[model samples]
Target: MPGSPNVLDLVHRSCTDVAAAHAEHVKIDDAAVSALAAELLQEREDVRAAVRGLPLPIKFSSLEQELTLLALYHLLDFGSGYDPLLTKTSGGRDARETLLFGLIGLHLGGTRMDHHKLKSFTMYDLYTTFNIEATQEVAVMPGVTMTKPGPLQPHAKALLTAINESGAALEEAGAKSPGELLLSLAEGLKKAGRTTAGAFVEELIDSLPGFRDSVLYDGRTLTLHRRAQNLAADLAIVYGGRDDRFAFSDVDQLAADSGATTIAVLRAKGVLQLSEELASTIDEGSELPAGPHERALRAAAVAACDRVVAAAAAQAAGSAEAAGPAAAAAGEEGEESGAAAGAGAAAAGAAAEAGKEGAGTGAGSTGPAPFRAVDVGAFLAFLTEEGRPLHGKITRHVTRDVTGY
Candidate 1:
């Protein structure tokens, strides 16, 4: 609060600091991403009209599902030359978006086709399956343009696996409406296969409103992560947190969960790009090394958390200093009352002086209530690592105190 600009400036410094720190650790690999592109991928008009106009047997049961599907599509909504984490001005989508689309696709459409069935669809065939012909391309969010790549497309192959399965099953069973199919399919899939995509879709559909909400949640989450990483890069430029192990370690301790190792913590924070599973573990996964840019993003995010903690500490210290005089006066008054009861005015004056000395000593010696920046690692955890929001009010406190950018 005292120095809003200084806190905001940390965003820039954290970028440089993190980039230098993770220069040799691991970086983002351009090839790993195959779908959307950047961390926060970006669109929707004609697609919405097309989705509405389609005469599909089983449409989305709820508006939430439809919206989630649309957002997912918009993210995949990429063109040629896609790379995750890249600037919108430079080209297409970035790696994060690509992976997101990949995840959504894999989760819904799946990578494998069902040869046993006469006809099968994946998430990619969004428009065709639905009879929504004539895909329109437009500029989505963040200014990167792409086609109607969402699930509600002309072909509905890889759209929502849940909606597709419900529809397909309903078609086979001669079910009448979309809502009925969703309810029946969701209830019937309880004992479905765990490894198969169809079963996964069934489980998702079974959850209904909550499932769709989760997708929306995931969208907001990934976006926040992307933005946080951008700020992290900015901070790295100012403070070289990654360059020093000690500095990084301080961040790692605050940002990491209990019993997490150095590399594990870094990976969880997205500073080290390993397999998602391995990233949560104590050991690094044997996967493709991350690129420097991605690593720098994580480094910056962590460094930014550390800076927030330091600021909180400083603020608490300042408050304590400001309170010293009031505390001294209170002590003086108490001492004066006690001495007046037992001794003369001369003694009371001496006692008052003693109280001032004690207050000064107490103020000087008492540390700032063991300054614990409870929210220091909250945003990092929310974005990179999986954890609760920062402790108590500090969670929101950082918006004004730590993050102005």
Candidate 2:
């Protein structure tokens, strides 16, 4: 199984390999990665707080409903290309938040969002549900205008395609909803002695076309599987320890959700150095078509985030080791000494385990959760969000024609 070609492995390997090969447009800076990783390590509490703040405010009637909403939310998590339009139309909510609020509104309005309901959704229904205006004014003659399909129409169409395709796949597999499908996959993987996040992702990609986020580059397939990987990570975060059904032994193996925002944050932090042409293109707010340049940026972000996690884990381990001697010496005084020694030992052990897991060995390690690339991604995402310190500095690369994000 170590050498097996799973989806997670493909994502990590292809991204790193392609990034190393295609450095002309985007270059990864090792020193910047180390510095950023150290900064994130020192701000671990902030990272955790940001991640904890991600869940929607709505209360679900059941785990099934929660899973369904989360799944649908991630499924349509794209449309960053329409972020400006979305912000203007939705009164300041970005693309991701808009989607979440829209889905929540649907649930509150008595829609179950089951596979059948998803399949039955029309374009008009989506426009209404997401609160996007259906038409835009197009200037035809001088001082005259005509109504045409809105700028967000393409994004709405893409969202519709993703949901309809996902629903069809789930229905074909005898799943009533996304939650049911995920539960079935988990149970089946457990029964087969292959209960890991990578396996879950592989199965999800195989089951749904919408999750197969890969492209052919230079005759080789470069896989990102951003939505699929995030779905697994989200499930682990939402259900870990609360429900055994979603416990993934190798949750630490997941890479960062490689998307436009991730790349932008990395670039802003100096981790990714883009060529003049690409930088101008992104800085000018132009749409980055899904091509070699865009793929290079995303792939570089994934690989750089992996390095960041590794560096952070190493720093944590070093700090723990440095404190171990003092802690052991403090244990020689009184009753509290024994507890201090035990805490030190536990901290050192956790740090070592975190280092191993952060290396991305795919060993089914259940290490300290904060040392994973997913956590690093969450931290960067939080920093770059609207009104955050890094918001004005980072220009998110926009790709309009793809639903992979």
Candidate 3:
């Protein structure tokens, strides 16, 4: 009993701390409703419960760490948009109406670790990077102008501190591996902030190779992948395991089990392309090549080029048909008119063939052509035998850490 803190005591302490922080918070007017105040207290408990559910190891990059902290700051100030305690003083919809106060608090509270104000750092960093600051005035009507005020107030600052401390706590809990830790941290962050944290964790998880054979990471965007089991299920459908090498074979079994029609459509599109690539491989002497991935991509490219040629031919045929009727009407009275028309059509065909030949010769050609192929033998004359001169520039950008940005 001497060392134990009961649940009631813990709840009272949290309420007291939040109430004190709320009192100290500076605002233009009394906008946060009593219901919202109560909801904030409830949110704290919910987030704490969510954190406890997370796995032991919690891992995250510094950028993710920063975002996690920012998310907590938002939640503490905004209450997840659903505080039921406001049944009495309720007229407005939600806490979003009081968002400016929340923003102001976060900006003023600044960094908990460094005790650096958010306004000072964000403005200073922005100015240093882009030669612009939030305070800089922009022209308005007549004499009116505006500029950002200084750092956030005490209440907002306290919320920011709480966020940073929670992140530090998660880091201290340490997990079995970087991946496990990341997942745990993500789950914890989700309790505090919701979808924002969920998405970050999902993207990181999808990037792990043990989790998925292939991952799609579009820098500054999204990632997509299929896990090992899901992949196996798909394989089971396609060829009934008759040929295990093909990815689609796995996908086919998955389609059967899941009743998904998309697998068939995708396979149909791929087969034509595969056929083209297979033909290319056969022409080069049926070895099937060493690199499956590269071969597949090349096959797709060849199929695309064929489609382009077919489309061009169709357009040419339609154009001649449209012109033929008009030409016949214009020359119905003469015999030599038919001969002249034939000559014009032959010339147009020759021109189209020449255009295709010229286009196939360009740098933009998707892959090697059917008749004429890429001349790999002339590579030394084009590329600097050692390397390109801009290699250093590219390396710097590719390896650059832009978190500071």
Best by lDDT: 2
Better candidate by TM-score, 1 or 3: 1
Best by TM-score: 2
Tens digits of lDDT, candidate 3, 192-233: 453231233233333322222221122211111222222222
Candidate 1: TM-score? Answer: 0.24
| Best-to-worst TM-score order | 2, 1, 3
Stretches off by above 4 angstroms in model 3 are 1-173, 177-186, 192-225, 228-265, 268-272, 279-405
lDDT of 2 by residue, 1-405 (tens): 435687777788899889988898899998998899788866766764444424677788887787878778777888788888889997688888888888888989998788888888887788778876657899999999998988888888888889888889999999999978888888888788887888888888888778778898888999888888888887776676676667788766788878877888899889999999999999999888888998888888889988887667657767678767867776776686888877877777766654554344332222333467877787788887669889778798878878877
Per-model C-alpha lDDT, please? 0.29, 0.79, 0.28
CA RMSD (A), model 2: 4.1
Error of 1 at 333 (Å): 7.5
**TM-score on alpha carbons, each prediction:** 0.24, 0.87, 0.18
Candidate 1 lDDT, tens digit per residue, 98-166?
334343443355322221121254443533232222344678878788886432232122234434554
Error of 2 at 23 (Å): 0.9
User: Candidates sorted by lDDT, descending order?
Assistant: 2, 1, 3
Q: On a 0 to 1 TM-score scale, where does candidate 3 land against the true structure?
A: 0.18
How does model 2 fare in lDDT?
Answer: 0.79
